[model samples]
Target: MSSAEVVLDLVRSRPPTLGEGRLLCIDGPAGSGKTTLASQVASAGGDAVVVHMDDLYEGWGGLAEVGAQLGTLLLPLAVGSSGSYRRWDWRLDGWAETVTIAPSSLLVLEGVGSGVSLFAALTTVLAWVEVPPELRLERGVARDGPGVAEHWAQWTHDEQAVFVRERTRERADVVLDGRVP
Candidate 1:
């Protein structure tokens, strides 16, 4: 089976760490398959709510800060309470809009800092997706286009610090080899 299918099966079998719904995190370096895998899991998860770290980051240097804010926004949701967070709009270069999380049976948070230690307690399963640096960069540039590509390296560097400090990959419940199929 494909990696995505494997992850879906895992999600299906694991119980939620919080209230009725499970909180899942799909985290990895830029260009890794986190987003894609999260998308697939969400599709299979039935009533899944997805929160992209891309929308959470303030900019290229916002990994740590954004990660700190995730829990405040999500913890309330654990008990089926409504919660909301303002999403960072890359184009407008500011906090563009608020994203409200309605209670769902499953929640998927995907991005570089999605699995940070601070939010560990809120997560039901933390997945670390990895691809070779070269392949990841190629895919990231291709998907985002040249404009965002210019900032990729800088973003990666910032992400590295959080990954190390939090030991995100080491603490993962599922580690996915996201190399090209």
Candidate 2:
């Protein structure tokens, strides 16, 4: 079967595939189709929780503090109970808003590095959304603007370092071009 067919099959049959209290992460570089695909999956099921990590990233805390939250809090909840999370607040530079995560057979978290293994041990799948670097850069530039040039450059460097260490793509269950879906 084709990759989309696989994804469609996996997502459509999610309650069975994911079971209760399992986390599924959809990760990709910025501008890949993570958000859209997560939405599609969530919408397909009547009871699926979708978490966007973009809300969790705020200011210079970067992944460091996010790691703290995941380790100290989210993982434990995912382990023991069905619960919802309040995504991090970027504008206020502190998290104030709480988003409800409905109880469901599938809990999908999307955005950059959502599939990274550190966040949850019981991951049902780690899907990597891939696109050419040129395309990634182009989409990133369009979304963030040239003002983020230095930031983008720095991220590219960090990502390169990370790819060497973390190997996000190699760990993925599925690799998607992401432009098509």
Candidate 3:
């Protein structure tokens, strides 16, 4: 079975942790394929809604404050209410339009800081994707362009701090290899 199928089965076997909804946090370093895995899971989940962490970030330096933003987006959902958050406009370098997420059977939060400890208890599944730093850097630059290499460098440093503090990989329900197709 595919990795996404495994995650779906795991979610099915567990009780709802986010009030009436199950939350799947696909988190890892930048360009580790967390988004790709999330897309697969969301497609297989039928009723799943995905919220990208990229949208929550304020800018290149937004990693440190992501938990606060996540709280705004997830706290209401934990009580079976609709949640909302303002998206960050990378080009404008400011807050953009507000996005609302209604309660659902499954919600996938995918990105670097999606597995924060603040919401661990409410998460039904936390999947960590892993890839070598060099490969990740290469993939990130390829996607975001060479101009953002410095941004990517700082991002890698910031994300590592969070991962180490949270022991994210150690606490993950599943660790996926981002090198796989």
Candidate 4:
């Protein structure tokens, strides 16, 4: 069965959080279909909004800072009211556009460490998408190309740190097998 199917079924079986103020976190490594799955979920989730944490980063160097702010400030605003932000463009490393999260929305934070400890209290469900390292590397290399070999090495370190601190996997309400784990 498709991973999305499993996730959809799992989510459907649970009480729908539609029209409720809650957060559902989809945490996983890069290229693990977090965005796609979250999109599928929020589409069916009544009054839901998908929030990409990647947009919170400030030129890839402010992940922790952005994450902290999201957990502490923006998420609460998003739960009941509209939230707004001026996002940083990764490629350009500059302010791009002002993004907004609406009230009574089902916000999906699809990025590694998104559902970290900071968000635990507000998160109603936590989903972890497990993708083996070899397969993950293969997919990553394919997308970023051989030119990113060094970058990947550094990313592995960053990922490890994030997971170590966040522990999003162990706290998962469900595990999503993306054909690799």
Query: Which candidate's TM-score is highest?
Result: 3
TM-score for each predicted model, relative to the true structure: 0.93, 0.77, 0.97, 0.80
lDDT of 4 by residue, 1-181 (tens): 6655565566555653423555677888876767777877777677667778777766445655536547433554644656676777877868798776665545566777777786566666788986788877887788768876676666667767787787768888888876632
TM-score of 3: 0.97
- Model 1 Cα lDDT, one tens digit per residue, 1-181: 8776776677669787657777888988888888888778777778888889888888777886856668657878877787677888887888887888887888888888888787778788888999889998889888989887778878888889888888989999878888743
Residue-by-residue lDDT tens digits, candidate 3, 1-181 = 7878888999989999887999999999999998888999999998999999999988988888879788877899999999999999988999999999999999999998899998999999999998998999888989889999878778888998989988999999999898774
Which should have the higher TM-score, number 2 or number 4? 4
lDDT of 4: 0.68
> Which 10 consecutive residues of model 1 have the lowest summed lDDT?
64-73
Best by lDDT: 3
Per-model lDDT: 0.81, 0.64, 0.91, 0.68
Model 4 spans > 4 angstroms off: 5-19
Model 3 error, position 8 (Å): 1.2
lDDT of 4 at 106: 50
Better of 2 and 3 by lDDT: 3
The TM-score that candidate 1 achieves is 0.93
Clashes of 2: 0
Worst 10 residues of 4 by lDDT: 11-20
Local error of candidate 2 at residue 46 (angstroms): 3.2
